[model samples]
Target: MISIPDEIGNLSGLITVELHLNDIEGSIPTRMKELMNLQQLDLRGNRLDCSISDEFCQLKNLGWLALSNNKIHGLVPTCLGNLTSLRYLDLGSNNLTSRLPSALWSLKDILELDLSSNALIGSIPPQIQNLRAITKLNPSRNKIAGNIPDRIGSLLSLQFLDLSLNFITGMIPKSMETLIDLRYLNVSHNKLRGEIPDGGLSKNLTGQSFMMNDALCGRNPSLQIQPCVNQISQQRSNLVEMHIAYTPRLNIMIDVTSGLEYLHEGYSSPIVHCDLKPSNVLLDEDMVAHVSDFGISKLLDSGQSKTKTKTLATIGYIAPEYDQKELCLQKEMFIALGLR
Candidate 1:
């Protein structure tokens, strides 16, 4: 049908409506609320336009709804959360805007949720942990910011998660290490930082799953980021216990200086290693020290001598000028060596 007839609403006993992959070009009828027994509705891959009507929430028996790939705009009706029987929902590839309604997280029985490729803003709320039965969650390609809630690990049944192409910041929550059922994850193209957890699902993730996130470091070589700085400190302890002879102090000093020199002059733009400390200097089997941990490093523009940053380096090793919000590579080595 070219368009759903408003008279179809007269079928009050209808339990399901599937009009996907059609040329349907009109708005969802408000009279749809008359179908009290409707348990499922699928209208994806259509040319339908206009905002989702709040009347749909009147269908208390709605267990599944799919409206992706439409011209749907405006806020998702907050009352949809009243449908406790909703087990699946897809509103992706639309023009929906505004913050995600907090009420959506109340869907405790939701099995899959797809809200990707929209203009939605705001952070994922902590109440998200209520979706304990969720198996797949996709909110990628939106403007959502803030941390991935630490409680996300509580989704014991979660096997697929995608939060890519957003403005999300902060470390991937350590609690995610507990997601034993997770088989796929993607947090790429975001502003995430710190160490990526090294257990469970994370162990199986590849670099492709985290590409374009410059500050994320992990022990997984496939992730292609730097090794976590804490791992270097752990290695140092192991070496000391094994009675391995420490590299000469002079050699370490030279190696560190050489590394800094390269950072300052070896590239098109100068890089300032914000955190320099003994623990951040990693030693290979050959006792060769390699400078690591660029999680908070900054790259200055050509001819720029200093820049401002909110991320603080190691407290004791931070240069005095850093406190003023000015950042440069100057004197950090001395501070790292406790000479200041």
Candidate 2:
């Protein structure tokens, strides 16, 4: 391995420096700022154990920068936001730490940004909504937490996004339901809960793209998730609210029962939703009530024939046999829906 010679920065009129795939080591010389006309700097696939130079931001004419597959560590310099002419950036496969600087979102001219495979922590700032010109963003394989920003859907030009293998929490933002241009998304292996939003860009992704988050539920059979309560509430809110006669109410009640039938008998294994109530019953776009809320549910395989321990259920809806033994699915659903 060889260390970059400091005197090499004397090339004042250098336009591009491609030293990738070498075994070069040591810090990137600070005098590199003298390359005022440099447009691209590719030092990837090296053993450089240097801090990413903050001085590189002074290369005002730079458009593409790739420093991946190095031993570079420490925080990404916020000064990078000053590279207004930059269009593509890749800093992946490094040992960089600390929260991503919100200032990086100010790169309005950037098209693709890759910061994956680092030790980055903290929440993705809402400032990302301002990157209206960006198309692809990959920040996977980090320690990021907090809810996904609601404004992510506002990036009309975004085509691909990957935030997998992080500590992200809370529901997938409802704002994401409007991402008309999103063709690819991966949010798996996080703490995200609630139902994956139906329709729009989300509908295009398969269950594999959203796996490992056990708290998540969805209406799509392909995802194998229990429908969420929030989806039901949204359906109810969209209704006309006219008073329905007894006959129409009966039909809604039957639909609710049929939903339970699928859970108890339609599947090879039976699923018992211990806490069934009106709030747990969600309606789809067609006003069909679907049983939901599997927070306290139990699964019964035909082979094991096991039952779950009793916890709490809604006051009026609790079954008599529930306190004595495992809940009986047929009786539990009837009592919960009958009173509603």
Candidate 3:
């Protein structure tokens, strides 16, 4: 602060400073730049404003910076790229805008970057791909738009990514599959379309990633988008087409016998696949998929059958009453939710 810069900067051996939760006023001190040994600084929740001094970037030893919830505005000083040892950066809830300094990616050791709730706009820079150590990134609630660079997946260490509440559009880059370490991802409420990687983060994420977009679908369980979601979403032909119609069709081999008429012949049941399982279904001589084992099938089942013919799936796939199957001895106890 301008009031105590002489006292605060006098401690040449000091490694950290916590001036948050105070009524500090005036521009940050030019003398505070004298803390050459400082490794951490937290000036959050202050009334600080004005473009940060270019000299602030002189603190090359600084490893962490948290100046969030301030009144700072104007482009983030490109000099920040000089903080090569930084591991954390949070500039959230500020008025900052303009093309983010490409130097930002210079912090190779950075683990978490939070620039959400700012006025930042423009395409997410391709230079961001250089940050290979990022573990969590929150760029939500901004004006960012344009195609998310295909290189975004290069952050193999990313554990959580939140790009929601923005104007971003275009198909999600397939390179995103490179993030095998991702546990939680939210690209919802954006314009990202296309299926996520089958072997990478896409496998661990869920339908939550592709929701709200007119044309986005993926293998992520949280984004349970149907084939139609991709059929209509043809933004980038360069990436692999992601549509439901291309669902894998398994090839089957079977043999037919005489005296056994076609089971579907004039059948009033219409033979909808309420429960499709290997035990309840089989392939005919014509190699056509069929449902046969109906030991625990439901009559009211039409669409996605919650209670299947058998206890074939795991917890998430089981019907609520299916757990009560322990009390009922019959093949069918309660009806599953579906069409009749």
TM agreement with the true structure for every prediction: 0.70, 0.66, 0.63
> Which ranges of candidate 3 are over 4 A from the true structure?
1-7, 219-222, 229-340
Candidate 1 residue 70 Cα shift, in angstroms, is: 0.7
Clashing pairs in 3: 206-222, 206-223, 207-221, 207-222, 207-223, 208-222, 227-244, 280-293
Q: Return whichever of 2 and 3 wins on lDDT.
A: 2
lDDT by residue for model 3 (6-113), tens: 566678788989888685666677777888999999988888875677877888898889988888788888888888888989988888986766778777779999
Better of 1 and 3 by lDDT: 1
Model 1 spans with C-alpha error above 4 angstroms: 232-340
Best by TM-score: 1
Against the correct fold, how does model 1 do in TM-score?
0.70
lDDT of 2 by residue, 1-340 (tens): 5977888788988898999998888879998888899999999999999788789889999999999999999999999998999999999999999788887899987999999999998898888987889999999999999989988878888888999999999988878877788889999999999878887855677887788998998877776666678767866755455433323777678887887778788878887777777778776757777787787777788754446565647655655546666544555666767643
Alpha-carbon runs more than 4 Å astray in model 2? 229-340
Error of 3 at 195 (Å): 2.6
| Highest lDDT model number | 1
Model 1, 216-253: lDDT tens per residue?
Answer: 88887777878878888887889785744544777877
Which lDDT values do the candidates have, in the order given? 0.87, 0.83, 0.67
In model 2, the Cα lDDT at residue 54 comes to 81
What's the true lDDT of residue 289 in model 2? 73
